[model samples]
Target: MHRSPTAEAEVAEELAEARPDLVSRYAAELPGARAAVLTRLWRALAYEPLPWVAARVTDGDGLSLRLVDGRRLDGPPADPYATAAYVTDVRLDGRTYDDPARLMTDLGVPHSSDLAAELGHSVASLALSRAGQPTVPPKEGPGADWEWEQRVVDGHPFHPNCRSRPGFSVTEQLAYGPEHRPLVGLRTVPVPAAECLVSGGWPEGMRDGERLLIPVHPWQAAHVLKRVGDEGPVAHPLMSLRTLALSGEGPHVKTALSARLTSSVRDISVYSIGVSATLSAFAESLASRTDGLLHFTRTLGAVTADSPDLAAVLRESPQTYAGSGERVVPVAALATTDLPSSAAWLAEFTRLALTVGLRLLDLGVALEAHGQNLLVVLSATGAPLRLVYRD
Candidate 1:
């Protein structure tokens, strides 16, 4: 039996036709990308509470997993936080497997095939993302905050499906992916005010008389909505692909994108829209007790056409919290800078983050301080200053 083409092969075929110039570069990036994804998968197997992983054994040879099916999966010791592509391959039942998708397929666990497909896409898309990055890392900080977001080419550091944009074609990935740094033109769907549930103050620029102009992601407009409106703001895509940063220090616009990205389909539900204002106010009040150590970007507005498929949320940019000579950077983009390598700096950042986090928790609030939602304000000397959290 002949096996189907892997996602990398499929992407290569697409690039060969649409952009032959990128074919060689994409191919060159595959080995590193594969190892990067394999490292994440190994981490998951070593630590995640998966039912099939019967037991974990560690010996002088490194880490080993005994599956419920009585097969052994072996690899190097997993470091959950390490970003380097240290994992080249792993042994599954005496057979060596380099590709994560292939290894998962041969493992033959329940739902492994579905995971295998996503892993394939993840490797391919990750390579494509790497191929588009600049050859040398930037020596200085970016002119705008959104540029720091684009620097995170590898997406989620721990997820195996970090770059698995299943519905996005190579062309679409290049055109819309934040790593590619494309200018995405947003569209606004007109919905009558009476038919919409709105919270906070909707921008007058987005109001069409009595109708609310809902911002829509181009991908969502084409694939889900099946209707496009007149050209709206041409903005920079942020770390969260559904959200975009408007030009010249404007708010970040979050659109309802109904496609599965990594784990879930990102769509603004009516319940969330209805509670936006209350939640924002509550979060703000909680943040106020932090005494200048923490900040929450306010949700400027939220609206929905009574459907998850058509909703929008406008929020103030986290950069708004940055004073002159300071930089507010998403935690995910910290790898692009040398700050993380400094033990002293990391300690300071840890203390500040824990201080705010513990303070909030003591006051009856637990923040989602994940890489994407959390940011650090760095002084002109690159010292950690404070923390910023947003959804």
Candidate 2:
């Protein structure tokens, strides 16, 4: 989140190119059209191991990464953006123990920290021990080791997602001190489905004021919405509506997108808005020119359905001219043709974006190049052809 778009996208593209196998694995998540473009965009990118790669231990897990020319990445699968973890060593809080034995008594459960964090006003319980508690055996693990515990507790460190995993649901603070504002856990639906932000609202004295939609990064929202309206896939891949708000790994796409955006080397521009708002804004942005939004959309749809070569150009231009803040559905998962080598796929991807004036290749941009983001539909010949992009 802290890195610039150029830096973020560049990093993502690098990762994508480095791990084509991952990208290929998640190709089904995207639609056919976007799969074409992103497949090419990602495949076109050159891969180079920035001098060296490294590894290390973060929290309780292992992390590995490379020291690319940009962001100072510590190796060994480390999250490059973990620097923005909600909890770090800086949050102010204190722990006191009246009886170390009582504190020492195991809570008798897995994920003790989570239990500790929520039991009897969780966090405050740490200070609940009677002044001086007996010394309980310190929790031992790569992350819960003696050194980390002593430093964090005595140092008053704030932990970020200590018990959370990547793409996990995040807990957002309820505003208005939960007085005028209602509190609800942000949820993520495995498959996109219709769900209200708050569950069973307005009970007696409580009144529901608002409902939030899927929580995604500012740049990603517009692009995904555009994909929803893109041609093909009359019924969503699942055919069932599954919507996941930014919660847990289910909806927390921010960091993943962060990795993608930070991985590209292009001019990224994003105007945050709802699905309708994005549509209207994009429409207006192109209204004054010879190419209206509808015309562009139809052109993409038509070319993709009929001519493979034309579809490639239609896909390419909009991505380029529209700017790399990556429009909705930048990548599709379906294969539209039976072609070999990156040339054919790249051509197909480029043609489709051209219709909308999104030149992803010309500008040297790669969006959602991750395995799960790019979808490649196969042709009769058993080769990937059509491309698509989705959440």
Candidate 3:
């Protein structure tokens, strides 16, 4: 039972909305595929306590009715794919209804209720699916699920949790949406150099050495305590992988965050309520959706925010040392000409740096956000997904 193109586009737009990074990264693989992704995501929720959602219909034959969510209506259709092809147009499960009861019979609430009504729920019970990863491994195969205590939620408005939520029921948090992050594993920073932030320590890892201004703002740092409590690697393996190039006109960003919250909310911003308050405000809304799903990230300089970029280089690029009182004008990293900045393909490099800086902002965790603080792994080209941490 496919819906109308407008309806499907709306759903895809919802899923692909806030996280500009996701759009930037995976737009290529999304348009033509989604039904199976939706099926896998919803089927996994069969016995869980996640919220009810409107299933997007995707089929082309007579009553190829699967539930719009995962369980479609068992009925007849004009030609199967004809009457309701909208669900696949944008490639999402119908449109998003904030009300769980309307999306699922289990919620059992009338659809006419205030659309803005807020609900609280946990993420543990929600179904997890690869909405659009290209290389989705078998659900039962090795590394089938990301297997983190965390799972993305499904809701009308996505809200990714900036803070950790321990000992919370997944079902109870579903209504709150993605704003509630499931902190089962340790989220470590990937910094390998000694810096002012962690005194040369890894941003999220345990201390290792000494550095100045190593201060990690409470806003940018996700969590630095304890290793992964599970059997997986101490940190997410994805961080160890290389990042992809920005093939888009700019950086390709795919993340889950509030569009309104995209700007820096640190003490520096006029609109910022400080890191804690900004996070709290986000949490309040997150608690409302608790769908364990809010994926939004933005791109900067339309590419990456790295030292090589003109904007980033000029603002934060390292300066070369010159003899004192020699009337010598300070030289720049590229100007030092030790390496070919020209060979660096300066244009592409700038775009890459901007992309990284912007995504980290969307994540709302502490970060130097400069080129030096970022990591770029060369591996991970065809994988379905991978974790990214700024050391």
Ranking by TM-score: 1, 2, 3
What TM-score does prediction 1 earn? 0.97
Candidate 2, superposed: residue stretches over 4 Å from native: 1-46, 49-283, 287-331, 336-352, 358-391
Query: Among these predicted structures, which one has the highest TM-score?
Result: 1
Best by lDDT: 1
- Candidate 2 per-residue lDDT over residues 334-382, each given as its tens digit: 2211232478766765554453345343344334344233433333333
Q: TM-scores of all models?
A: 0.97, 0.22, 0.20
Candidates in order have lDDT scores of: 0.90, 0.23, 0.24
Q: What is candidate 3's lDDT per residue for 1-391, written digit by digit as tens?
A: 3222322333335445444444433334333223222232233233234354343333454232343356443222223212111232111134443222123333233431221111111111122112333244334311211121112122211121111122222222222222233222212223323321110112222223431111121112222222222221121111101111112122211111111221121112212211323343454353234232121221121101111110000011111111122111111112222222354444444554455445445666434442212322111221111112222
Using TM-score as the yardstick, the better of models 2 and 3 is: 2
lDDT of 1 by residue, 271-385 (tens): 9999999999998988888889999999999999999999999999999999999999999999888888999998999999999988888888788798999999999999989
Name model 3 segments beyond 4 Å from true.
Answer: 4-32, 50-196, 199-391
Q: What are the root-mean-square deviations of the candidates from the true structure over C-alphas? A: 1.7, 22.4, 21.4
Candidate 1 shows a clash count of: 0
Report the Cα lDDT for candidate 3.
Answer: 0.24
